[model samples]
Target: MNDIPEPNNESDSSAPIHEARLWRDDGWTARVIKNEDDDGWAVEMIKDGEAEPALVGPWTMGRDKKNPKPLDTGAFNTLVKTASEVLRRHEQQLHALLHKSIAVTTDSGTINVVLDIVPDEDDPYAMLSATDEFGDAIAEVRVAPTFKLTRASAEAWIESGYRKPR
Candidate 1:
């Protein structure tokens, strides 16, 4: 689903309605929308500056059993925490997929080894690079994205003068 645009904060008079169906706060917005499949309500939690909701789940019905329960401070705080954690985990996973690094000690000195992957549907590949303690680039080579980067393999590559892996 596409992210909803952030509401403008400059004009309080222009703020959207804060009924039980929808509400907004400093860093998050909570909306209780109807479930199309059944006679129930679903709540969506969206973070600021994000286009899509971080979470969507079932919501409780009001005492009248005809409307959704109103969003309060306690519930809003819990939703914010849950949504923030979801975003954090997603970012970490993406970083792991795109970049990896390790440290290895050779006869000369310890070098920082890095592998960055370029994910393309037709031509996926990875770049293997090394840097000295002073952050000077020592070598770089392109290899398959699934290439295994081990200490022995990296040492061998360095010994071979950064030859392209076959």
Candidate 2:
């Protein structure tokens, strides 16, 4: 019986269940199931409170060849580690895309600039801001999400008396 019911976000999630081919613990569930692509098996690692699995990959065959390797503490731990790393990398990439920062020295002082983007479905936008060396906000303005922030642009903005970039 591979038909394990998944818990929804609003309900009581994060339950722990340990079975032969299905194991749930530590905010993740590991399930070994038949691979739809081939006669081999596949394992999926789903984080608790999430409907979709975070990681899915081929599984090793057991001694019987026809059977899938059962879930164990060691295997489950490895899967959790891998899936966690995958999520971490994805988050890092997203942060890199949504946020940018640059620092430069001018006659006034060192200015730290940052661009934060909001990827709204209906109204995407970004906020371009700058702070002095003492972490005092110098300027902040809303800009198009497509705004490109660079050292030259920062210098130009500073030279323009912190006016909205054209």
Candidate 3:
């Protein structure tokens, strides 16, 4: 027997699932949606550069039956924080997988930049470190993977002098 329940198209047969989009400028994204089978809500967080979402936590219901606690400033702020964390964790993992060391041809001969990705096991945090040719640390940064790491992004970073560590 088929275990998956097929999509039932009867609109009024189930509770209406309300939809709302949550977006952030700092590479965080989420969607707050009402459950169709029950009187509940859920929030889905999608991190940057991740193929799958990090979390789908339940949302709070408002006093009124027909409406939810408005998506006010507080709500937006909380969502941003949650989504950002998710992205950070995702990036940390990718950074770990991306172990690369390269030598740059600067005016003064060549300098080696060692790239390291350290993942935060307890929390949703990741660290990227860049070391100089002599193994001296140049810069270290905590990154959120919500930013794309494609060739386009790489080219953009190079063009921008790699000032921003996303």
Candidate 4:
């Protein structure tokens, strides 16, 4: 399924003004975008490879409206951690849906873990991984899949844990 599509014509602004900015922590990278139309912002965390955004939610405006809280060591660190978890969970769900045949024997018995991976256009190494369960890798193709692996449930499968059968 088509979750979040990149803006077709991103406004050319030096700063993230109304665009998403990339943040890096340890090895994970997160994209923080300003929601000009809304009162909040959205964050997307990416790991190794996957499709879609890891965490897409509201962001605080700190204390000022014109200025957002600066991206510092502590703030960046916290964002990375939270974003990573979001990505991880998303990856697990996507995996489950992809491989419905593969029964994940959880305590519930025969639980499924689906996942999907959205690749980065600029860089071939980045992708968004989300899953249904917790830590399963399902749709792990390159940045972008040659074929279509689209669906919310299927997307959730990618989020779940559906690796490329490898």
Q: Model 2, range 13-40, lDDT digits (tens) per residue?
A: 5667677778888989898878989989
Q: Candidate 2 — which residues are off by over 4 angstroms?
A: 1-13
Identify the candidate with maximal lDDT: 2
Instruction: Please provide, for model 4 over 50-162, each residue's C-alpha lDDT reduced to its tens digit, 9 standing for 90 to 100.
Output: 46555565555657674344445665678767877776786687775343333334443343432233344665332334333544543433334433334443334443455
lDDT, candidates in the order shown: 0.80, 0.89, 0.53, 0.48
Listed in order, each prediction's TM-score against the native is: 0.73, 0.90, 0.39, 0.39
lDDT score, candidate 3, position 94: 74
Q: List where candidate 3 sits over 4 angstroms from the true fold.
A: 1-30, 36-38, 45-55, 65-67, 100-166
**Lowest lDDT block of 10, candidate 2:** 4-13
Best by TM-score: 2
- Candidate numbers sorted by lDDT from highest down: 2, 1, 3, 4
Better of 1 and 4 by lDDT: 1
Give the local distance difference test score of model 1.
Answer: 0.80
Displacement of residue 93 (Cα, Å) in model 3 is 1.1
Q: What are the per-residue Cα lDDT tens digits for candidate 1 across 1-166?
A: 5233334567672354455556677667888777666988888888767779999889889999987888887787788788889889998998998898888887789898898998999999999999998899998888999987878877778878889877
TM accuracy, model 4 = 0.39
